[model samples]
Target: MTDFITRFAPSPTGPLHLGHAYSAILAHDMARAANGQFLLRIEDTDLQRSKPEWDALIRQDLTWLGLHWDGPVLRQSMQLTSYDTYLAQLAARDLLYPCSCSRADIRAALTAPQEGHPHEVYPGTCKQRLMSDRKPGDALRLHLDRALALLTDDFPRFVETGEAHKGTHQIDPSQAHTQIGDVVLSRKGEDIVAYFLASAIDDARQDITHVIRGEDLFDFTAIQVILLTLLNLPVPTYHHHRLIRDDHGKRLAKRDDARAIATYRAEGKTPADIRAMIGL
Candidate 1:
């Protein structure tokens, strides 16, 4: 509990489930334990999926769990300008390029059957495209190769305090090249910010000392660290907590309405019950 400035940032695309409860409670409890700050951020950057009702429901669910924050909630939609400002910074260093590849286009670009995760590594379809060539309906992608080359020193290793990956971890240059190819910064057809860029900027802006999130996001952290380093922002310690899974051992998702916090509340479950359920 040396540094406990953490946040519970949930996308307002759907309902908050038991998984959300565990993350929110864990962050809140950690901050309280250290007499530190806990912040809430509504990650409603997916304009197409984000809804006002879902945002309201998220607040309601967290409140019912008895969690409190130090200051007002910060919504990412209002921080569009900040995202743009940072994107421009990357562009200034020639570390960004315009990409026009759709999912289908990217798949077609691959010469072989790629395994593991979909969009695991971009085929670099639009790497040749320049900023001046950017047009509507094109995504802005990070030139990861250039970005890594821009690093003056070794990629920063971050400290993890969560049950999973609880140690110091560093990123290897070779792994980034073959696996995490140029990731999209802004979406096609608009200036919509992607998760890594927006979250990095928000964390810096909030002065967040630690990032507490699910291990599902553990792999992509290197990209965020890369972005933070290039932008010359302080990188925080990351704690990738274990995921709350269903009876089948599959991790919970928002679609699991049965596990939604609201559903449990309707069935008369208390906050303490939730703590026991998630093995707090």
Candidate 2:
């Protein structure tokens, strides 16, 4: 058996902000402390937003912060074939269906007030439709009901080692169906692979034993756990650390260039300064 393996996956959509630094440093330290391997994965799945320059800057920023990854950095762009294979497998099991609804359509369909969540819960407009029934531009969605039925009485659960919520949480299918809804596995055009699908598959493919990321993603872990279970992939322990927010208590985004590590570097802030800023 291998030692604990973890990864720091970042999209190259923009500059590496302080939040990125904190997460990367945390993942690196954890792997180093355990004498395990820390891997870097470039989540460049969004072909429209992801840029090669940003990808290069990500590496440079991590290295500047004294965080080094083991092995060659895994680029998601190079693994489209693998993603296709997994998607096909899910389709073969009848766990996936074609979704033709747009964001406007879903919002218009869901007339009832929704609870506060990070993402908008998708209304099941295309749940009954199969791939054959889909039009040319239809996207793919997971049949949540059918997928959960596969578990039957044995619902999926995962261990959370993060400070905020640490325990084995049971995934209630009823709550998931209503709250989470049927998430999109692919878009109408351009890149076919979705964030959840790609990350889940990559984690299993790299034999990642632990996933250390921001707490914003904590709520969505259940969805990924479900997908992993459906695909017969090994689920890893999760540690979602506290997020770094601005003065307004808003989570740092890639566009927060003022708080970006590169900007800090330009201002002659040392690595220790960054560590102090993010409370690492």
Candidate 3:
């Protein structure tokens, strides 16, 4: 088998900030320490928000941080056909259906309040809808109930490290059914790939063995794990690292221009300074 392969996939919707630098450095450090390969993936799946200039800036920022990736950089936008293939495969199995619910409709249907979660839970309004009954401008959603059944009967339980949960963790089939309901595989504006679909497919295609990312995505991991199981894709070990937060305890965002890597580089901050800043 190939050595451990880890990747740093950043959405090029905006400039790289301090949080991006910390996550990239951590992944690169781990890959280097294992004598494995570190890869770069441009997660420009959100075409409406992604920009060519930001993508170029991301490459430049990582290079300036003294982190070099192995092999050619992968771009999600260029892999739409591959995502489509997997989407079709899932649809053929009757594991996916089209939903006509809009954001406002979903929000209005949310009966219960969020319980310590960032976003309100989806009420599965479209879970039982027939694909043929839906019209265009509808989003594609996976059938989480059927997916859990296939996973529980066909595959053994899998576990991975989680930063939020303190150690190794496994997804209980029952909990997955309750918590994840049905998630979007693609949206109306997006062709046939949403973040959950594209991310799971990309990791499988790239043969990623370890996924090192920020803690904010810890909850989202469950959804991706479900997708991996449904698609019969290998589940890579995950390492959700600590996030870099500002003085207000808010996580760094692309809008935090003061924390942009370009600003730091232009201000004569060396690579060592960045390491120190992020406590690497």
- The candidate that achieves the highest lDDT relative to the unseen native structure: 2
Q: Please give the ranking of all candidate structures by lDDT, highest first, separated by commas.
A: 2, 1, 3
Candidate 2 has which clashing residue pairs, if any? none
Stretches of candidate 2 off by over 4 Å are 103-117
TM-score of 1: 0.92
lDDT of 2 by residue, 1-280 (tens): 4679999999898999989888999999999999999999998877767899999999999999999999999998887667877888888988889877775543232221212334666767677887778777677788888889889889989999999999999898878887677777765555547788889999999999999998888877888999999889999999999988899888888777999999999999999999999998
Identify the superior model by TM-score, candidate 2 or candidate 3: 2
lDDT, residue 95, model 3: 87
191 Cα displacement, candidate 2 (Å): 2.8
- Candidates 1 and 2 compared: the better one by lDDT is 2
lDDT of each: 0.82, 0.84, 0.78
Q: lDDT score, residue 143, model 3?
A: 84
Model 1 agreement with the true structure over 179-270: per-residue lDDT tens digits: 67788787654436788788888998899998988887777788889999899998998988888999988888788899999999999999
Off by over 4 Å in 3: 103-117, 154-156, 162-167
- Residues 1-280, model 3: lDDT tens digits: 5678999998887899889899999999999999999999998766767799999999999998999999999998887777877877888888888777775543222211122335444577777887776676677778877777776655444445654666555667666666556777775554546677788788999999998888777666787877787678998888878889999888787888999999999999998999999999
Error of 2 at 19 (Å): 0.7
